[model samples]
Target chain A: MPHATGKITARELIDLQSHLMLESTLVGQFNHFARESTDPQFGQLCQKLAHSRTDCLQRLAQHTNITPIQ
Target chain B: MYQDQVTDKNLCLAVINQLKWSATCLTGKILECEDEQLRQDYMQLLNRTFAEQKEAFDLAHQRGWYQPMMADQQMIGQVQSDTQKLMMEQQQSMSPMHQMAQYQGIQAPQGLNNYQQSFTNPNLQNQSIYVGGGQPYYSR
Candidate 1:
């Protein structure tokens, strides 16, 4: 019989959090760079990167039940 | 049961690390691109990769197989802190120049501000003036 234990491992939680944060930071940096960029191409690239990061954040959130830091 | 759990955890860690490295590569490419369009394209690709990585992370988490591969959190924290400090230093180095330019603009715009404000106002159409004493013209 499978026991319904609400407890989860601390290491797992930390690892999940760390990866999510790293992805979020990367996306934020891309967005910031995009906004600062004068070149249209670079701005577009930054936007794309920011979008990717946001997607990653969403997926991670879905998996871990972690709400994004708005 | 313990062995199976450990194996699953290791596998999840491996997948996560792979995704992390891929993301790092994308980040490097973004930093390297000089052309804005190229950078934008690469950033888009990076985003797609990040989405994939997130999916993988979520999959592992859902299965309850994820585990921290790093033994020392302090080391990672130190590196992150150092990176933040460097970024702050760079921003601070550039801020004074920006502040000076802003100050100059503000000082020079003492009269221009009022002129601009008047021109922008919709209700101030009756007070329009040209070089010559033209009639109060309301431009569309």
Candidate 2:
């Protein structure tokens, strides 16, 4: 029911894009941390975090249907 | 040597710190966001990130990577006493202002009192000055 018209302002679109970018960047950082970790458990923890952030990124991207232009 | 010093604990700490900052950034953005839908969406993300950050912190604590310092009883008592002292000082400072306000409520202001007195003043009665006119204008 929220945003029933599905219309987004330029400012909203920019915010969405920035959120997506931050999420993506977090995912990359977690992935890198996973690889850099010496302990297997720590690596798995980073992987889980990365996956969670990815899910969040995907959810926001799908909700707003906006992605930052490369 | 620096690379060698990087351990699992250090890596976990790094991730935890990053998550903490990310949550803070999201909070600020959500506060500033004007759109209703965007605010709601970002609020959800912020909650999730905060939960995940807590999880990371717990894991680190369990593994002895992050040991939060526990406050001693003496320190706790000192803080409580200091806070009470500050409260007492604030109340004391406000007492004079409160008394002044109450006193003012019962008395007319000086300016109003002077203006009221001016109308009843006998010396100023029937006194006026000529303003480039042949006749003097009397004021009562």
How many clashes (backbone atoms < 3 Å, residues ≥3 apart in a chain or on different chains) does model 2 have? 0
Pairs of residues clashing in candidate 2? none
Tens digits of per-residue lDDT for model 2, B8-81: 88888888888888888788778777767778878888888888888888889889989989999999999999
- Predicted model with the maximum DockQ: 2
User: What is chain B's TM-score across the candidates, in the order shown?
Assistant: 0.41, 0.65
Which sections of candidate 1 miss by over 4 Å?
A1-8, A66-70, B1-47, B50-140
Poorly placed runs, candidate 2 (over 4 Å): A1-14, A63-70, B1-4, B70-81, B101-140
Worst 10 residues of 1 chain B by lDDT: B128-137
For A1-70, candidate 1 gives per-residue lDDT tens digits of 1112333245444544665677777676667666665546445655765786687567555435434333
- Each candidate's fnat, listed in order, reads 0.00, 0.44
Scored by lDDT, the top model is 2
Clashing residue pairs, backbone N/CA/C < 3 A, model 1? A41-B36, A41-B37, A42-B36, A44-B40, A45-B39, A45-B40, A52-B47
